[model samples]
Target: MRVKRYVVNALPEAVSMIRSELGKDAVILNTKEIRVGGFMGMFSKKKMEVIAAIESNQANTPAQPQRKASPQANEALEQILHTVQRTASAVMEPPIVTPAEKQTGRVEQEQSIIDEIRDLRQYMVKLSKQQGDHTALSEQLYELKEHLLEQEVEMQWVERLIQAIIDKQTEQKSEFTKEQIWQLAAEQLEDWLRPYGGIGISSAVRVVHFVGPTGVGKTTTIAKLAAEQTIKQGRKVGFITSDTYRIAAVDQLRTYANILNVPLEVVFSPMDLPRAFKQLEERELIYMDTAGRNFRSELHVSEVNSLLHTSEDSETVLVLSLTGKTKDMAAVADHFSKYGVRKVLFTKLDETSVYGAIFNLIMNFEMYPTYLASGQTVPDDIDRFQIETYIQHLLGSSSR
Candidate 1:
C-alpha cells in the first residue's frame, strides 16, 4: 500500500488532490486540523490534513538492471531528482514509484504502453463522473443496501394463500372489483379478531368507559372521544365520572364537560352509578371516566371492579401508555383483563421513540387498539385506529 498525506484549507480540495494523484481506489485513513508551529501557532491558521493510502500493483516487482544513461535520459533523471528534493524539503517524505521489471530498449513498445495508460486514465475519469460519492449519495446507498437485506421473511403458508387467490381469479376469468377486494380484506381482518368477537356500532345508547392504571391519560382520552362524537359527528354525548375517589379526577372530567357543554355526573359508588346512567339514558353515546389506580394494588382493583360490575351492558376499554416497557404493559394488560376489557386505547404515542412494545402487547394479549392518542392536545391529537397508518408511522415512513 502507498500512503500519502496532503494539507489544504478545505476538505474538498484535499479529497480532490488524493483522487487526482492516487485515483478512486485510495482509502482515506484519517483527517484532522492542526497548527503548523508550536509557540507561533497563535498566529498560524489551522490547516486541514488528510492521510490516504492506495494499493500499488508494481510494488512487489523485482528490480531491473540499470541501463547506460543517454544524454536525454540524464536530463529527465535530473528533472525528476529536482522535483523529489523540493517535495522532501516541504514534507516528511517524497512520493516513490517502483522501477520497471524489464529495461526494454524498444522505443515503439514504450510509446504503445504510454498510449494504453492514457486510455485507461480516460476510462477511470468516465467512471468517476458516472458515480460520485458525496455524503448524501453514500447515505442513500447505505439505506438501500440495508432495506434490501433487512426485509422480513413471511411464512410459506401466507405465500401459498396469495398464490391461491391469484389462481382462483385467473381460473374464473374475472378481475377483483373494489367491493370484492374490500370484502376479502374485511374477512381476513375479522378472522384475526375472531377471539375478541364481532364489533358492532351500539344502537341502544350504550356507554363506553375508559379504565386503566395511573398516568395512562384516561380523562384526556374520554374528553377526546366526547368532543369527536358530539362536536364533529353531532351525536348526543354525555359524560359520567366514577372517578370520585380523587377530587382532582372529578374536577378534570368537569372541566372537559364545561368546555364541551355536556352533562357530567359523578358516581361515588356502585349504587350511585345506576343513577348516573339514568341521567344520560336518552343520549346517543355516553363516556365514563374512571379513576386512574395502580393495578398491583388489590384494593384499587376491587374498587374498580365494583364500579364496572354495576353496569353489565357498558363496554369497558383499557387505556395503556405506549411509553411503557413491553413486560410492564403485558402485566398491566393482564391485571386489567379482570375488569372485562373489551378494547384497548393506547396513549402517549408521540412521547415514545420505540413502538415495538405496541406490537408486542397487541400480539401477545390478542387485543386490537380502538384508538390512538398521540399528543396532549384536546380533540385534535387523537386518531381512529388504522393498522396500515400506524405500521407505516412506526416504521419511519416520512409520508405518514
Candidate 2:
C-alpha cells in the first residue's frame, strides 16, 4: 500500500496532487480541515489536508501482454484477474511455434494482448463501480456525522461514530442507505454508552444523592425512583434532604415521604448528614436530595461534595435536564463530577426536540444516564435507560 498526506489551500488542489502523484488508481482515505501559518493564535490560515492511498498491482507478470496502461489495480481487481487467468489456463493448452511460423507467433502475441486488455477493461469498469460505491458511502458517513452532531453529540464522539460506521459499511458489499447508516450508528451508540441501565443499584446502594442545577425536576425524579423501589420493587427506600436552603423543597419531599410511608430527613449542614444517615441506615435504599446548586459557584459544588462525602459508601446521580443547553449540562456535570458521580439521570425528555446533550454528557464524562424522567408522574414517568429509545431519539424517530 502507498499512503500520502497532502496539505493544500483547497480540496481541489489536494485532489489534483493525489491524482498526479498516485495516478487514477489512488483513493482518498480521509480528509480533515487544518490551520496553518498562525502567530500566537492570531490570523491563522485555514487549509485542507487529505490522505490518499493506492495498492500495487498484484497480478502483473513479465510474460503478460503489453498495454499503454496496466490493469486498473486494487485488491478487487487483483482477485478478478486471478480468477480469469486460472480459468483460461485450465481450459486450454499452449501450442509450439516453428521458425517458419514466427509471423503467426507475432499474431498470437498481439491477440493475447487484445484478450488481456479486454479482461483488464472489465476490471477497470469494476474498479470504477467500487470507487463510486465508496464515494456514496462516504457521503452517507458525512450525513450520519451531521445527524449526530445536530443532536448535540460532541465532536470527538461524532468522529468516532463515523469511523465505526465506515468499518461496518466496508464489511458489506451492499449499498449503504440512510436506514443502514442509522442501524450501524445506533449499534455504535449503544456500544460506547456502556454500563447503562437502572441506576446500577438497588438495596445495595446505601446512600445516593440526586444533584443538579435548579429546575431540572430533581426532586420529582427522586420521588419517582423512591416510589418504584418501595411500592413496585418492594425495597425499603428513604429520603434525606440537604435542600433546607429552599423551604418549599423540604416540604415537597416531605409530602412525597408521607404519601409513600417513608422517612425524609432534612439536613441543615454536612454535620447533620451523619445523624440523618443514622436515622435512615435501617432502610435498604437511602436517596439524598441535595440542594440544586449554581454551577457557576465552585463553593456550592464543594459544599455538596462535603455533604455527600460523609458516607464513604455512596453514589451520586448527576441529574441533568434534557431541555437545557448542552453547554450548561456539560459544565454542570463537570462541576459536580468532583463529588464522584457514578451515573447520570436525564429529566424532561418530553420537553426538548434536541437530545444530543444527553449523548454529549455521556461521552464527554464517560458516564451513562441510568434513567430518564419524561414527565411529572411518580414511577410511571421514570424509565430505565433503554438503548432503543435513545437510538430512536438520535435517529429522530422518537420524541426528542
Candidate 3:
C-alpha cells in the first residue's frame, strides 16, 4: 500500500489533492480535526488531517477510462473496498493444517475456526457496509439512499445502509422494488439500533432529573410524565423546578401540578435540593426540572451535575429536540455524557419530518432513549422508545 497524509482546511480540498496526486484508486483511511502552527496554545488553525492509501499494483497500473462517477468518490470507494476485502479475507480464512497433523488437534482447530468465523462473518458484514462504495448502487438502493439523506441521516450511515441492501441484492440475485429496498434498510437499521432500545425511566427510581438546552420542552415533558404516573398508574408524583430563570416556568409547571393534584417545589440552587426533596418526600416519584442552560459548555453541565447530587436512587435524563441541529445536539450530548448522563428523551417529533437526528444521537453516544414526545398532549403523545415504531417514522410511508 502507498499511504500519504494531507492536512487541509476541509475534506473536499483533501479529496481534490488526493485524486490529482495519488490517482483515482486512493481511499481515505481516516480523517480527524487537528490544530497546527500556534504558539502558547493560542491562535491555532483548525484543519482536517486525512490519511489516504492505494494498492501498489493499482498505483503502477495505467489509467483506465473514467466512468460517470466523480474521481473523488471512485477513489474513496476503491480504498475502502480494498481495506474491507483484505480484512475480511484475513478473518474468514484460517491457517492451513498439514494432513499428517494430529487428528484430535485438527478437529479442535477446525471447530474453533468455525465458531469464530460465524461471529466474525456478522461483524465483517457491518464492516463491509460501513466502508463500501455508494456511487454505483442500484436504482432502488439509490432511491433509498436519497430518501435517507433527505431525512438528514449522516452520510457514513447512509453509505452503510445502502451497502447492506446492495449486499442482500447481490446474494439473492433478484430485482427489488422501492418498497423491498426500504424493508431491507429498515431491517438493517433495527439490527443496528436493537441494543439501545427498550429502556426508559425506571419505576423503582425515586427521582428523575430532566436536563437540556433551553426551549426543548423539558418543562412540558416533565408535566407529561408526572401526569402519566399520577393519573394512569395511581403513583403519587411531585415536581421540582430550578428553572426560576425562565419567566412563567414555575406557573406552567404549577398548572400541571394542580391538574394532577401533585405537590410542587421550587429550588433556586443546589443547596436547596435537600429542603425540596424533603417537601416531596411523601410522593412516590419526583421529576425535577432543571434550568436549561447552554449545556454544550462543560461548565454548565457540571453545574447541573452538582444539583443532581443525592443519596436516593436517581437517574438524569437528557432532553433533546428533533428541531435542533444534529451537530449542536451532539455537542450538548457529548458534554452531558462526560458527566455520566446515559439516558435521553427526545421531544418535538411532530414538528419535524426529519427524524435522523434521534438515530444519530442514540447511535453516536450509546445513550439509551427513554421516550419520544411528538405533540403537546400530556402523556398521550409521549411513548416509550420502540424500535419498530421509530423505524416506521424514520422510513416514512413510501419508499419512493
Best by TM-score: 3
Best prediction by lDDT = 3
Q: What is the clash count of model 3?
A: 0
List the candidate 3 regions with Cα displacement exceeding 4 Å. Answer: 1-135
User: Which residue runs does candidate 2 get wrong by more than 4 Å?
Assistant: 1-139, 171-174, 195-199, 398-400
List of clashing residue pairs for candidate 3: none
Q: Kindly list the per-residue Cα lDDT of model 2 for residues 239-282, writing each as its tens digit.
A: 99988778799999999999999998888887887888888778
- Worst 10 contiguous positions by lDDT, candidate 3: 124-133
lDDT of 3: 0.81
Question: Model 2 misses residue 355 by how many Å?
Answer: 1.4
Compared with the true structure, the alpha-carbon lDDT of candidate 2 equals: 0.73
Greater lDDT among 1 and 3 belongs to 3
Better of 1 and 2 by TM-score: 2
Deviation of model 2 at 352, angstroms: 1.0
TM-score per model over all chains: 0.50, 0.63, 0.68
lDDT of 1 at 336: 69
